[model samples]
Target: LEAYQKFVFEEDRLRSVQIAHHICSLMQRGNVVVRWKLYHSVFNPVLQRGVKLAHHCQHSSVTSAQMHSCPHHDQCLPQEVLQVYLKTLPALLKS
Candidate 1:
């Protein structure tokens, strides 16, 4: 069972590498369809879910969407972290 699990994990890792390489090639070729599909199908949903969760716990008086201030810090939690994360698109693209 352990060997089988290891094999499966290795297979998954190889597949991930292959997928990344294929995506890189598509990017080099300037394939908008492939890039958009990767973002809309994969990345956008993940970001939307996280943003939804952030909004759900926010106080009504917070005013700004995800910009609600964290109680511990003077600045809004959303503005400080989530917005910052969203702004770092170049870093994400690098990954």
Candidate 2:
């Protein structure tokens, strides 16, 4: 979890996505519960940053939406961390 958080919150955009994709690949090799936990740590943060990171991934949203603050969840990094990872979050969260 600490490594995941460090990569997401401390690393640069390029490195973060690189780590995310690598992590995604590795997660597929793990059991269901392990995958779920790791994926949650990875994507839940991005889901919160969807409005911000999605635009980085070429997703659409209003200017105000990106600027909007989500105080309930901890502050997300201002940079894009996981675009591809966002693709996996919902299903894993459901599972």
Candidate 3:
């Protein structure tokens, strides 16, 4: 039971990380409405998954103490990509 739970947690975390990266890529090329839709459709779910992963890590006895050591903890979108996205978000929202 513990092993399976850990596996599922890791799987979800990896998938969420991939989605985060994809969202950044889409933001780089898509227009305002497209980005807006993608944010609502895709990014929200990834955010939820991240929240779930964090909760799981916090609750899991095997991981509670080592939460910060998890590789996936830092696997989300890169800083530069996120900065670019933030810079464009205001312009996109205005349009």
Best by lDDT: 2
lDDT on C-alpha atoms for all candidate structures? 0.42, 0.60, 0.51
**Best-matching candidate per TM-score:** 2
Task: Report the candidate with higher lDDT, 2 versus 3.
Answer: 2
lDDT of 3 at 58: 61
lDDT of 3 by residue, 23-49 (tens): 566766788787767676654444555
Error of 1 at 3 (Å): 24
What RMSD does each model have against the real structure?
11.9, 6.5, 9.4
Model 2 TM-score? 0.55
List model 2 lDDT by residue over 4-64, tens digit each.
7677665366877777777766676678887868757865665667654444435333243
How well does candidate 1 score on lDDT at residue 40? 55
On a 0 to 1 TM-score scale, where does candidate 3 land against the true structure? Answer: 0.44
